[model samples]
Target chain A: MNAIEFHSLSKFYGKHRGIEGIDFSVSKGEVFGFIGPNGAGKSTAIRTLLGLLHPSSGSASILGHDVVKEGVQARLKVGYLPSEVDFYPEMTSRELLEYHAGLYGIEKGEKRIEELAQYFELALDRPIDDLSYGNKKKCAIIQAVLHEPEVLILDEPTGGLDPFMQNRFFELLESLNKKGVTVFFSSHILSEIQRMCDRAAVIREGKITAIEDISSLLSKQMKKVRLVLKKETKLSLPDGFQNHHSTGSKHNFDYVGPTEVLIRWLAEQDLVDVVLTEPDLESIFMNYYQR
Target chain B: MSMNRTLYFKELKRNRKNTLIWTSIVVAFTFLILSIYPSFSQMGDQMTELMSSLPEEYARALGMDEGTWSSIIGFYSTYYGIYITLLMGIFTASTGATIVGKEERDGTAEFLLTRPMTRSTIVTTKFLALGTLLAVVYSTQTFFAVLGMNVFGDDVLWRHFVTMHVHGFVLVSFFTAAAVLFSSFLSPKLNYMGPVVGMIFGSFFLDAIAKATEQVSWLGYISPYHYLQLQAESGSLEVNWGSCIVLMILSLIMLKAGHARYLKRDIVG
Candidate 1:
């Protein structure tokens, strides 16, 4: 069974479309990424799937339990970390986690809470109101994983963490995923997706535009080519090359298509120096948006 | 009655301070009104003359009559309906409105709704908490009022006091449900005190005006206060079981409607 499924699920806030025809499923134990820019229905889709918002049409399920009809069962196996952390300000981190554990009927969460608190370097005694954004986020992270849920649904999970803390969080996620935990990671940051996702679905304006494998997506985009020819010679570029420019012995352009064809073409040129750079995920994400 | 104990307790603790403060106010007012009854009782016919001198419409609107200064229950009933019920209603009804809505207002709905519990469970647990808090305030004030009556009045009139309290409890419960219903339809960010006070005070005055004016007596039918009489006409006061049951039924309906609304609500960030 899929860890999570949204079969033609749609949500509308009256006439305003929140998410439309959002069809996708995450495989068990796979790290699946849901990527989009802000207001692109990423959070809307996440919220709907988590049963926070009712689906206007169709349905969603987690671990084969219907999110709307069998929401308690569906949510039982999943842990959700929201993009924004807003805990009860009166309670300390310890109290909030203990309360969360109580709701889940966890009888022995105090030890787990202490261990996670120690790991994250978060002060468990301080009120949530007094904690910094990063500290609060750490607290959120602790709660999300405290139950050791089978599925982790994270929306922009790394937002307020410093680089070192982010690194630790990613390591924790990696360990959890290795334990056969499925992760549905939603974020606007391309680099985070590139690092954590095996495959990613790109959302645009409340619809899924494309779902691409990380390696295949990287390999399929155009590469930036810069070369220093032996002399400035007039050259007829091939079909896959565009935006060619030359000055003295230097030539710069972009290449898309078969790497072997480019290699063969480059072999024919008298080159003194050559440089080929793969575009970052950010550029590729923008490329998808522009397309 | 199906409830999450964790959430129920958390909610009660959350409103504990507010409940304490409001309960204190009601308890203090209960004592003050009971304590001054002796002075009024000492005035004898002078008090009766004073009550008689007031305009008929004004006396009717305040639920005050010549019988008001005669006994502890009558005098206590006057202020109990106007001030005590309003005060307690403001606290419970306003608390009722904010209990679930506060999570939404503070952007914590995402966290709360995402829990393993269903929305129905959350609503049920929250309402249970509101009921518990209401009981704390209502019973505490009633206890102090009973104590005050014993200390201040010779006859005590326990039966009349019971009748007044029963009616007062029903009135406050009705308003509490109304607040929950209103919150489901209105924005969570609203300062519920204005609308809550308006609803409670509005009902009181609507019933009062209807009593004061013959042409608009129909208006009293719309107010819950009219059905649930806080003060009696003569020294003998009877608990209106029919009105109490009907208002309680309506309260349940409003509460059920609010619960249904919350179940389908899009808990936005």
Candidate 2:
């Protein structure tokens, strides 16, 4: 069964486009990634799915319940972590979690909250405002997952976490996914999406460019190569190269072929300088648009 | 519709400090205002003669329209009433405006909207909490007023005093509702307090202008202050009933509009 389904969902802030024609479904237990640059409508689509924003058109359902018409029911089995976490500043983290647990009717979730807190190394006694950004994020994650929700929708869920905490968070998500929790992860971090998602939907400028399995997505991946030649030279074009340009012996292009082929070709060029880097999601989307 | 009890208490707890502060302000101000009644009464005819000699507009501005300063009821209505209404209006307006909008302003709307509760429930819980806080503050105002009147003046007219406070509550309810309505459309960058203060003080100014000028007298109908002042002046149960109806209708309309706007709002931070 599909854990989540969005059918041509669109949201506009007055004349400003948020997300348009957003359609996809996350199968039960699937780790679905929503990859886009900032202001590319990934958060908009997720917020609409959570019923935080009403869609201008179309609909979304979670666990077979309509998010708009039956948001309460849809959210009963869903856990959401926003891109930026903020809580009642005066309340202690423990108080906030207890309050959330009460809302979810998880009477026995105290043990789970404690477990999650200990796992995240979060100090539950401190007020939310007193905690650092990473600590606040830990509190958010605990509240989201304490109910053992069937679906977890996270928007940029790991921004402030240290490397150790981030790895621990990933491990926790992995275990939860193993237990049949569907995950909808939204982030602009290409590598994080690549590492964690089974399938990813690429949104750019309020529209979905592609929705494909992670393996297929990897195949379409493009690396940006920047080289500064000692002098301007008429170089033979490489088959994998596109968007090739040279300015005063400085040349750049997106290479889609094997890394070795690009390296081999570059070795034969005039000696100067070269830099290889993974292109951001926007640049990749631009490449996809060109194709 | 399931009402989340946890959310209700959390909202009440969130507003606890604010409620205490407003309550204290009203209580302390009541003591300060009513304490002067003894000195005010000692002057008696001299004070009345001096007050009546002032220009009619200036006297009206001081809330001394055909009311003497010697009697506790007259003094209470003339001076204490204005301060009480203004303070309560500000407190209630600020409370109502911030109750829902603060979550969005602080970027906690995302945290709140994701919970297993409907938007209607969220609105109802917060609105009810605001109502509760207002009730607590008004009760303190009434308590302090009664205590002050008994200690500083002759036998307090308990019935009239209670009725006055009930009328004051209605006036504050209108301001609170208007504030909440304004908050629904306001940007987070624009603090709700500014608009609340503007609306409360603007209406008071309009109420004063209506009192001073014959041409814009109809403007009095638009101000909640006028409705409240009518109740204070009449001191009739029938007038109080009519005022209650008007205030209730106005408050309900604003609340309904705010609830609808809030339910449909796109919470982005």
Candidate 3:
């Protein structure tokens, strides 16, 4: 079953356009990444899905419930961590988490609160205003996942984390996904999505340009192969090789066809080394936006 | 239901200090006004004696004929009523303005909105919090004002005190509703200014129309302070129960409209 579905969703503020004709779906238990630059309507789409904003046109549904008409019901199974997490300054992290747990009607909420606090290695006694940005984000993440929700919507979840903490967050998300939680996250960091998501949608200028399986998208548009010959040599390339650029020591070419032709061509030359690197999600995203 | 109760209590806990401070201020001012009633009564007699020596136009211009020294109700109606009403209106409106908009100012709306509760629930909970605070403040002030009046004067009846307080509550309700309505539409940084300016201008306009022409007497009907007349000679100074009901209904309707707008409008980041 699809966990979320958006059909031609559009939003506008006065005459300023937010997003238009956005459509996508995330399957249950799949990690879907939404890749976009800042102000590309990534947050707008997420807010619409969470029923925090009304779409000017089209519809959005989560777990078979319309976001507009059945907002409370749709939100019951969803956990969200906003990009900029804010909390009551006077409440301690533990108090805030308990407050959120109560909202969800979680039984024995203290147990879940303690477990999440320990998992994140966060000090629960510190007031929210006294905590660092990363700690506040930890509180947000803990609150989002503590209820054991069926779907997680995270916006730039690792924006402020150090590399070690980012890895820890990835592991935490992976553990939750293993338990059948569908994760839909937006991020500017392409490598995170490349490594974690099963599928990703690239959005540019308020529209989704592509939604494809991570492997398929990378393999189709991002294969870059470099051939280094033993001696200075001019080489003829295969049919699918286009946009070929060369330096003195190596030739860089992008291909959209089978790898065999490149291999056959390399066999004809005295190649000292040949290196192939698939374009990461970042490169693919930049390429589309630049165009 | 339990969640709503929890949220309500939390809001109260967060705002209790400010509510207590403002309530104390309003009550102290009410008591102070009551304490000065004797001085004003003495002045009224001295003014009457002095007016006996003056021309009729000067005495008439000062309203010496209509003014009386013995009646505490008259003292309130002519002197303290409008002053206290304006004070209460500003306080109530400012409190309401800060209720919802402060969440946005503190950057806490994002956290609150991401919870499992619906948008309407959040708005309604905040509205209840503001309502409770306004009621507590106005009630406390009314209690102290009546206590001071009864202890200082003989002719002040308990029924008059009750009527005055009922009118105060209705006026406060109108201001609270107006402030909340503005808070829902304006940014938090600018929200407080709207209510303050609205109350000041609204009172001024009502007062001007009341003094200008007999034909414009109906304009006072639009002002919340209009129904607070406590010195009608015919003993017809009962509470304007119809206007009170309308104000309460208007407050609820504004709250509903705020909830709907907040639920549908996008956050400004």
Candidate 4:
């Protein structure tokens, strides 16, 4: 059975559309990515499946159990890491994790909690109110994985983390995926999605626009190219380049074609230096929106 | 309809500080009110003359009479009807209104509702914690009042005290349940203290005004405080078992409705 499925699931906040006809599935042990810009219903879809929001129509299920009907059963094997962390400010991280362990009926979660805390370099004794946003997020991660859940639903899990922590977190996710845990990863960061997902579903304005293998998605990668030339000279541009503008001897433009072709074109030019940068996710999303 | 013991206890612990603060206030007020009864009891003919001088309607409206100052229980009953029950109702009702919604308001609902427990269990557990808090505050105040009466007053009518307290307890419980029901339809970010105080004070004054003026006596039926008497009348008091049972049933219905509403609520973060 698929690890997670949303069969025409929809949610509305009264008349405001949260998500419309969201239909998708994550196969068991698959690292499936849900990608969208902010307010594009990525969180809504995740929240609905986690039973935080009641669907306006249709249904969702986790591990073959209906999210709304058999919510407890569905949730038993699922661990969720929310986008925003808001723990009870009065309790220390240790107290909060113990409380979380208590809720999941994990009698021996102390060892797991300590292990994750050490891995993340998180302080266990400080009150949540006293912790930084990044520390709170670390606490959130530890709680999410402490139960050894079979299905991991992570919504923007890397927010408020340093590069080192983010790296560790991704590594941990990779290890969990290797352990046969199905992961439904949701984020607006395209790089994170590209790095972590095997396949990804792109959502725009509460609708699933595209679902593609990471290989094909990478082939459509958009790059920002900047060139500083040897003297000012006009050169004919290729078909896939747009927004080309020049100031003095430097030229900048966005490219959305094969890197080799762009390189072959760049090699033919009289150049001082050339820079190719991955455009921001917003740009990538705009490219998808155009598609 | 399952109650989680772990959540139940955690909820209680969460509200422990507020409970301790409010409990201390009520207990201290109980002792203070009872401690001053002696000074009034010694007024004798002066106090009677004062009661006679006051407007009769005003006296009845405030649940006061000449005999109210004659005994410890009767004296305690007047303040209990006005300030004490109002205080208890406000604390419990405000707590009931926020216990579940606070999670939603603070963005913790995403973490909580995602847990391996049904929404019913959350509602059931939180409300049970609310009830336990009400009992703790109520019983603590009652214990201190009893101790104060023994220390400060003579010929204390213990039976009347029990009847008054039972009535007050029922009134507070019903208000707490009603607040839970009311909160389900409103935003969690709302300042419920205003409405909670309004409800309790509104019920008290409505009953008071109805008793004061016969023309508006029908209005008393609309308030929960009317059915439950908190003051002794005709030098005697008894637990109104019929009213108690009806209010208890209504409280249960409100709770069930609130639970159903909460179960279907979109716990927005």
What TM-score goes with each of the models?
0.97, 0.87, 0.89, 0.91
* Models sorted by lDDT, best on top: 1, 4, 2, 3
Candidate 1 Cα lDDT to native: 0.91
lDDT of 2 at A194: 74
Q: Which prediction has the highest TM-score against the true structure?
A: 1
lDDT of 3 by residue, B1-269 (tens): 22376778889999888778877777777777677778767787675575466655433222223443346765554444556666767777887777777877887776676666777788788888878887787777777777887876767756756776777677677777877777778877775855576775576467446534457767767765565553433334577788778878887887677767676656666
lDDT of 1 by residue, B102-145 (tens): 99999988888888898888999999999999999999999999
Chain A in model 4: its TM-score? 0.84
Off by over 4 Å in 3: A230-239, A247-249, A270-272, B1-3, B38-44, B47-69, B76-80, B212-222, B230-236, B249-252
Candidate DockQ values, in order, are 0.87, 0.66, 0.58, 0.76
| DockQ top scorer | 1
Clashing pairs in 4: none
Q: Is candidate 2 or candidate 3 better by TM-score?
A: 3
lDDT score, candidate 3: 0.77
Best by lDDT: 1
How would you order the candidates by TM-score, starting with the best? 1, 4, 3, 2
Shift of residue A208 alpha carbon in model 3, Å: 2.1
Worst 10 residues of 4 chain A by lDDT: A278-287
Residue A112: error of model 2 in Å?
1.3
| Candidate closer to the true structure by DockQ (higher is better), 2 or 3 | 2
